[model samples]
Target chain A: MDTRILLGAFIVYSLSTFFYLLNLTSERKNSYGRIAHFLLLSAFIIHIMSVVARYFIAGYTPITNSHEALSFFSLCIAGFFLYVKKIYKVEILGAVILPVVLVILIFATAMPSDIRPLPPVLNSYWLPIHTIFSFIGNAIFLVSFFISITYLIVEKGLKEKRFSFSIMRFPSLEVLDSINYRCMSYGFIFLTIGIITGSIWASNAWGAYWSWDPKETWSLITWIIYAVLIHNRMAIGWRGRKTAYMMILGFFSMLVMFFGVNFLLGGLHSYM
Target chain B: MSDIQLLAFGFNHTTAPVEVREKLYVSEEEIPSFLQELKDTCIRELVFLYTCNRMEVYICADDREKAMESLYRVFCNRFKIRPEYLSNYTYTLEDKEVFRHLFLVASGLDSMVIGEPQILGQVKDAYRIATTFNCTGFYLDKIFHKTFNVAKRIRTETKIGYNPVSISSMAVELSKKIFGDLKRKKILVIGAGEMCEIALRHFQKEGIADISVTNRTFANAKRLAEEIIGTPYPFEDIPLLLTEVDMVLSSTGASRPIIDKPLITTVMKKRKNKPLFLIDIAVPRDIEPDVNNIENVYLYDIDDLKDLSQKHLSDRMKEAEKAKKIIEEEVEKLSRAINQVDVAPLISHIVEKFEATRENELKKYIVKLKNVDDDTLKTIDILTRGIVNKLIHPYIAMIKENGNPAVLETMKKIFRFGEDDEEKLDNRKQGE
Candidate 1:
């Protein structure tokens, strides 16, 4: 995928987030909504093509070799969220999270277009599988992002005596919580697979199955947050604002693994 | 005023215990028979809404006194409650009063919880059951449909169900009552339906985190399973899931009893009889009727929704009343407009005739002799038409006054009622 095309898709998604957020007080019209859905579909397809084009240029999948995979995962997260929001008729949900997706994709586009292939140790079938699952896992955390936004706004609306017209466009609190669990549950599974695949590839490359690397530790931390959320939801009846808050905090750990681990903390997962 | 008849009766948490509510439940099985009893009433439109909190029957009749007597006696006979229990609690709404009551009830104003949305669904279900028995008539159908639409308008235009604790949120409250602390419990959902998702989501939010899922299909079950990190087991895995899980919510669409007698009994023996709260939300019933017999087994079928709905209503009384007022005001405005539509056309016609004559006089002077061409003659005709409108506009407007008080009163009443007949009559008179 051309970095420019991927950048363009990010811009389109970012604008949609703006338009949908502007729609909060504005009258909701199906005509514009239908247009919004088509635009997002177009953007998702374009985004996929961008990733494919980049792979063709890179000679091997861009999923390996660190920097590209992390950036690609964020765009994947945006595309998945936009698709899910449209399916459920909760398009406003995209308004809260797509901005983050746009920023991550923009950052990915700003990096060097390409030059290096994976090290002889980096080439493996598990690398692509691991990357795909890990991206999918992070996409679920994005869903939690949207739901937490809705829970807060709805609470404020109800508490004030006047229901915000913008809140009307959002899903019910029950539906919001449901979406969060759905995201966290899927994200958990994907992360588990990601860890397993990373371990297997690491052993193949360096003769070890387990290493307490920064990226690995951070991924584990993300996994624990989701585990607590699921446990709270099933056993203790922990949901609503508290669960939403935890989901967000967990996503932050994921954020650290992405940007902070690479540029700020400079871990093995980081690339020059 | 004709001898219009009205009867308003309901059984809610305020009036009836859960045992009595279960007895008078008028289940999906009983709805068919209840409508059969109402078939012979002189009532034009009949609505039967049964919830754990209340069973309300609103009948529209010209002879309000007789209709109330007949409807009240049926309730007295069915529940075996005495007449003393009837007049004191039962409310009667005849003619216009019936219209207001239906609107109020549909809007959730008359409910103990004033703004709850469940009554609309319950009312729809009751109407559907009545239709199955071929009991609802023209008047009831129109009125109830109108009532529902008005309720919809109030919901959309205002914030009726937005405040206080909602019924779904309170479902968690019921869970807390059973388990004391939610964090220690495990929830197993039997199906992948919306309610199961909602209940699972709620339990997840509450902090009771261990969860398992057993659905009809393994793939959907696995998918939801992968997301939640719960074991996605097959249907045969249910008995095992139930014993280990503290709460089980079954919302599957099964033809016969899916959770039959032998399955629940064997399952209960596994966990030394841990408190099993089973919410059977399915219509045909996913759990066996005999499942209720097991010790420490609290089985709540759809009948319990009415009570749950009632508890929510009491918690939301103020909002319900506000929503009801909005619906009633809307109905009143509609009735007044319906009344005017009948009389307005009669006034429009007499004015049209006066305008036509004035045009002829003005055109004779615009000179029929002027260019003797089609284009020139058309322009002259338009000029004369304007003159006619200016000349006859006042006289036509005064016909609505008609110099008669009786005519005015009749039109006022017709518009107040918003009957379709009056509008048709004006259309007929205008045609002639």
Candidate 2:
């Protein structure tokens, strides 16, 4: 039943992504964005149901396996996206962000989701705290990454005196830049707390506060990149193309930390 | 009484020069008395639309020639122009042509600047004034209502009014395209000239609050700033102030370029490479042409703005064709409705006559018969009613389907449906 709900959410999210893509290519119309928003909200509700159902059945938060973790990451992204959309009224952001959610969901559905008893090593309250904060932070960064990408495209088009569909569809550079900064700052704070919680949990579970595991190292790397970006933006007024480039780099590092560390590096964090 | 005819006579920018239109222009204070005078004339119903570009009168009357003559006499008397002089500039239309002309005018197709939107508002104002003066009857009321609907339909269904033709509005549109919202953006106006003031007014209409005005002559800039509720800054402070503003509108009388690429590039550095939109509408270009090549700067001169507005005007002209098609369709629909009204009484009269005769004969027979049951009486009544309906259905259908004037006239003459009776029926319908 949980898988069915997750699959339902996946299908709806795919449809929502299709609509957002259509909105991106077509002449500016509010109807396409409205439909996409409705579908995205529906998918978010079903996804919450799936996660809550798994939490009830398995007797723990549902971030145990790679499948569950990736799914939760995508869910957080959708949640943050809907929140930003409500607050900012930037409907065109979906064109850049929804496809990323779709890809994550597709990868998540491909992974296995089976009921597993909690291992003694994983039986701690800190598990949920660490994963939840980390995933939320990652989701926020994902949004910033896409917004930064759109900003770069629009900025380039304006600079070159060539107005394309993308240039016409996206919001102004100032708006996009402000949203990117907001996401980066919020994501930075969440990741800081997440890293702190993970260290505390590591000490409690493994008798160490720091590990040289690939996931741990890559998370640190992503953190450093964002730290530099936020610092430069706030202190030195680093903005426009440079900040946008840093956001893209930070998001890629996060992708590697989330997926590569589990599949290729086989670290102690591989269980997730 | 003769058949009421729809009549429209007008002088527009195209038909007459401004001097002739000025001669017939009606002030707002004079409209009520003018309408009273028109009501005293042969026109039973009338609406006078007076605007800067046109002076038109739409009337409903029993005799078109008499109404026209009276209107010509009134124009001569009111404006003190001879009938011969007025005749040289005035054009007249009647019936369906009148409807087509009014629809075209309401939809902005007949505007001096094609597809301009203010004429629709002026038409609505004329309608309201006519209503207030009790100069509108059913025919004029229906036409104005239909006109408003056609105007709204054209505005929505076609792109007739989508583009801005004026230079000031075009500048505002360009700024909106760049900034998304002008409310938060800061604008600096250089050289308090007429064009700059007009563009500032457009920006004000767009709800822009943050504005600064600068000029070589500080007193003029201060006066313009006070008028537009903007802060006045000295001209030499523009380059320093440029770092804080998102857009610059310059219409100064300068022989040399007031803004250059190096100046904007330095400002861009201070702004951290944020975009800047510069509009140089001065005749002798206020901003350097090479400023457009600078990064994060979009500069448009007066000629460029004119070209953009011209392009938009051409786009509206293309959409005007679609708007005309909509008006044509609406005119046809309105004509059909009017025709339905014309023939409705005749059809109803024929049906009423047949039913009354059938009822009279049935009543006489019922009295002659004895001990008639209720069911039998009902059956007899239904049978007679059915036969009468069947006999009259073809004629009613024919009159309604064709609604040809000749057929209506022939039927009216044959049945001796007097004009007084038709007038009574129309009034009765209006009361209902």
User: Top DockQ: which candidate number?
Assistant: 2
Q: Please report, as a residue range, the 10-residue window in candidate 1 chain B with the lowest summed lDDT.
A: B1-10
Interface DockQ of each model: 0.07, 0.31
Candidate with the greatest lDDT versus the true structure: 2
Candidate 1, A63-127: lDDT as tens digits: 76445764677767766676567556676665566667667676666766675856766577876
> Is model 1 an incorrect, acceptable, medium or high docking prediction?
incorrect
Candidate 2: pairs in clash: none
TM-score of each: 0.48, 0.87
Per-model i-RMS: 12.5, 3.5
Best by TM-score: 2
The ten-residue window of minimal lDDT in model 2 chain A covers A159-168
Global lDDT of each model? Answer: 0.67, 0.85
